[model samples]
Target: MTDLQQNYAHVYNNSVGFGRYPCLILIDFAQAYFDPDCPLYAEVDSALASALRLRKTAQTANIPIVLTKMTYDVAGVTGGRFFEKAKPLEAFLPGRATGEFAKGLVPQPTEIVVEKQYPSAFFGTSLASTLICLGCDSVLLTGLTTSGCVRASCVDAMSHGFRTIVVADACGDRHDAPHQANLFDMKAKYADVVSEAAALEHLATLVTRG
Candidate 1:
């Protein structure tokens, strides 16, 4: 193991296995993150592809899906401090195509879509209550900007008493450094970080027994 890995090995290395009922939460997989011309673009095409596959698997298993998108009023009235700090958030203002959910992975009519003005979907949103209402014991997270929204959502999910699982290959950042670093930190401190393949395998088991 690398020296850094060895150092953290003794500290934050606990796995929270999947629970009886798990829901998939896709955080901010909006067009802005995929559009090459957008400043918020994160080179997340691979992540989006993996998320599409994961979504199909979850749908077949009859698992609940929750999607989140960053949205704000034209004048940024609701976004407040977060909007001020991150000027790039302007891309999500009303009428901006960047704020819309990516085409292929749009939430179905029965699925939940929580529009928020902040990073964590749980913050100022009904996500926690909605998860409870759905009887979800765990959350499988997939989305963009690993160091930002994805990390925040994972931490909030864990805080809400859900076994948070971050699909490593299904989440991306503009650069590898933050993406990898956040994944390592999340795996150690906040949530279980698993590959998309592993998550799909677990979901398949659910489908088989049901």
Candidate 2:
């Protein structure tokens, strides 16, 4: 297994670095993932902390920010097949407190809030268009469940012609194995999995230029 991973890196060793315009996309940092009583509780407080730090940097740099939350119609019809496949999604049903952003991660009024019913934020939403309209050439993605919505959004962001940068420290999952594996996979193919310090340094450049 180790040998194959090394071989794949040689095969897919290409990097799409940060672009001139970047938007920080915070995906599904919902209270459900932080609440102990919820099935989706990830117990990844540190990842949430890293995301908050990045959010502050993005704001200071005047970068566009987009926050996404999973939501479904009261009857769950909006979630479609994904909802049926993942029963834990009930936590995101309308008016449920678990659907709200986690304590330290609230969207400012000027930031965009995209309510998505599917795993990929761009699947049935205006995310791609919104980013394009904002003149964004890159996506700085962070959020819960690195192997799930974060991975999905990374791929979709790339497909939509944006360079996707996944902040490694800012993405959490139910367990470390999936989180690490998914981060490896994304860095190899879809997105650039980068550290919080690296992301902050990049944002610092933007601030200096302005």
Candidate 3:
């Protein structure tokens, strides 16, 4: 193995295992990729498939599900530094299909959809209160752009007292290297880095035991 592979292996081996986690949060796996003309586009069919499976598992296990959409205002009230930089990309305009959730990853009627303006879902958002209200002490995080939004959410969730589980196969990025790097860092410091299969198994145990 290369040095990078060795580092990642060490990180994964040292990660904390899962216990009783109740909620699942899916980040942006939206259709914004269909337009090849856009800069933020990603062909994340595999990640979407993993997310779909996890969504079903969460529903069956009776865990609350939350989905996030990165949205921009008409008057541009929400634009921060990231948004400013992303204006050239412009793939996530509100009301466009690109801003909508991916084809097979739609939220169930009971699932909550949150519109976020920032990288971290918990930052300046109701995510903390929502999780608290649902009695969620653990969160299964699955979504797109593992290096950016996923990493930010995982760190914030850990800070908010939720045991965070980042579903490795269920998250992706436009570039694979950054994705792997962020996943490694998150596993080392903040969350349990797990495959979707393992996460489903743990969720099942929690459901059956509850």
Top TM-score: which candidate number? Answer: 1
How would the candidate models be sorted by lDDT, starting from the highest? 2, 1, 3
The 0-to-1 C-alpha lDDT of every candidate, in the order given, reads 0.91, 0.92, 0.81
Please tell me which model should have the higher TM-score, number 2 or number 3: 2
How do all the candidates rank in terms of TM-score, highest first? 1, 2, 3
Model 2 bad stretches (over 4 Å)? none
Please identify which of the two predictions, 1 or 2, would achieve the higher lDDT against the true structure.
Answer: 2
Q: What is the C-alpha RMSD of each candidate to the true structure, in Å?
A: 0.8, 1.2, 2.2
TM-score of 3: 0.90
Can you write out model 1's per-residue Cα lDDT over 1-210, one digit (the tens) per residue?
999989988688999898888999888999998888899987889999998899899988898998898989889989999999999999999999998988797679978999988889899999899889989999999998899999998899999999999999999999999999999999999999999989999999989977
Per-candidate TM equals 0.98, 0.97, 0.90
lDDT of 3 at 99: 76
Tens digit per residue, CA lDDT, model 2, 70-153: 988998999888899999999999899999999988679889999999988898999999889889999999988899999999
Error (Å) of candidate 3 at residue 191 is 1.1
* Superposed model 3: Cα runs more than 4 Å off: 1-13
